[model samples]
Target: MKYRIVEQTRPGGMLAQVYREVLVPAFPPEELESEESLAETLETGLGSLLVAVDDTGRPAAAAFGHWWEASRVQMLANLAVKPGTRGHGLGGRLLRDAVDAWRERYDPCLIVAEIESPDARMVHEDYGDPRRRLGFYESAGARVLDLPYFQPGIGGASRRVQGMLLLVIHADPTFTPERLDRLSGKLLRAFITEYLAAAEGEPANDWDAKALFRAFDREGGIPMGRWGTRP
Candidate 1:
């Protein structure tokens, strides 16, 4: 099947509808912004969003990333495929395009993605086991940098038993110590606010690059980089 990447906008865009009707249905409303709000956020230029259309010109998958200036990193915020279109590698194709688009503008751009940890309570209760989701990214060279953390919702109300896996992919071959530091810092911050702080119980409120680096360094299940590295 043919594929083409389009910006988040277009008349009756499939990306917009899918986000509203499909992805949101599986998660708490407070946990994510509504499709209309997301569309507005994307239009503000704080990030980039894209949708993939199959040969029939129907939207099949979508992904988006927000720029973190403090760490000079790009945080991949959302990725989803149309329900029946999954398992066809459309998600990976969309991700490839997102990475390539970022590389054109930023050298050695560090990419970060967050997935639900396998044992998370939310996953078990709401989404069922997360092995398939985790496995998909792991096969894509994503490494889990930290234990699952809580994801905060509206008005300081938090979702309990929710944890996230932080995965990093460094694109710049000339990545320097300084660049790594910045990228790592951003990842840590993201982990704290996005995952750690939102957790229930007495989870640690602080983390640093060294801590995250050590976490991933000790684990070796997934291939570290590139598509062919796995399998």
Candidate 2:
């Protein structure tokens, strides 16, 4: 029952058994990435991965991410554990190990991930337990963002009510107005914009008008330097 967390910087290596046998079977359709598209992104340094393998050398769990090089931020593209490996704490261990390595190696400003908000009204809550996912992230010390957020419908009609909330953890929590803006507009939006655009076969842009607007609306853009005070 030995397990080891390993980094897989190349797509071909991680995407082989982990992508097909583990990740594909674990995520639902909307959350799943198209293999070709994901592989392309991986090869281009737009994505990264960390996997946990069992004693038998079979992958037990993984964390997939979309990384923005300029600002040093990563989006938790996906995280999953093999079906038979559930309840063994492998998922959390794998995530913690990856986060530790990323912080020590890359020193990213922050790592952000989106999880479905349990707004009982959304149909997606029934499909996936938002509460369960949130709890897992919270246990890992990830902050639950209060700001409005949404994930673009992947290969489907618009789904604005799915209530996707951004869960972010900072390498350092201190914030200045400039840092806040970077976190809000420059960093967060960059990853989100790329994530959605990738699915649509489009390109990532400035991210201010399109994705940011959709997440925060026009008149009131992200409140600068007010991350922790707002309700």
Candidate 3:
């Protein structure tokens, strides 16, 4: 079960294999970034790609995410373990490590995750069970942000995916839910605005982005919710 972390890109490296073998099969097209897009993100230094390689030198898991400087947010875009390698805690280990690495590199204030809602319609059988995925993230210390959430389309012919859950993990070691039940609405607005702008090329121009932004903007602060509940 030993694993070593390796950074990769799309230039026919191990990352290419991971995109083909793990990411492509794990995520629906709408949620998964195109390999070229991922590569560009890495190349441009806007994204980080980490692969967990087994002792046999095979990739067992992958984590890809971006650092949003405007909001000091770390966006964990995708974390997937190879299908047959589940139940051994590989996914959780990789998640923790990925967040730690990003923290050292970017010093983000918040860690954000975009997950499919457990109550939403399944994108496909291969997308896996949303409940199980939420459980995994919750067990790893992520809490859902209570907000009307939707993922902006990856452009092209893709459509926006709604009923998504926005999860957050506090960077402060002493942070507790008892101390604060909600996050700053202004900060959330910044994150959402930047995220939308990044995804849609212009946040104000995209209907879904505008609505999502307003959801956070109108709130003084956003309350946190349990993972399995609807937003």
Enumerate residue pairs that collide in model 2: none
- The sequence of per-residue lDDT tens digits that candidate 3 reaches over residues 1-231 is 798988753344786888888899999888988888887877777788889998998888889988787888888999998877887888888898888888888888788899998887766666778888888888887888877788776773146778898888654433333346667777777777777767766545555556666766544457776765535
Q: List the candidate 3 regions with Cα displacement exceeding 4 Å.
A: 8-12, 123-125, 156-158, 171-179, 205-210, 218-220, 228-231
- Candidate 2 has a TM-score of 0.75
Which predicted model would earn the best lDDT?
3
**What are the lDDT figures for the candidates, one per model?**
0.56, 0.65, 0.78
| TM-score leader | 3
TM-score, every prediction? 0.66, 0.75, 0.88
| Global Cα lDDT for candidate 3 | 0.78
The total of clashing pairs for model 3 equals 0
Model 3: which ten-residue window has the lowest total lDDT? 170-179
Clashing pairs in 1: 108-172, 149-195, 150-195, 150-198, 150-199
RMSD of each: 6.5, 4.8, 2.9
Q: Tell me the tens digit of each residue's lDDT in model 1 across 23-112.
A: 665455545655665665566655577877778776666776766554466767777776667778887878888888876765434677
Model 2 poorest ten-residue lDDT run: 218-227
When sorted by TM-score, best at the front, the candidate numbers are: 3, 2, 1
lDDT of 2 by residue, 134-224 (tens): 6778778777655556666565334332557777755444322444433344445555555556454454243432545465433333443
Task: List ranges where model 1 is wrong by over 4 Å.
Answer: 9-15, 26-31, 121-129, 152-161, 171-187, 190-231
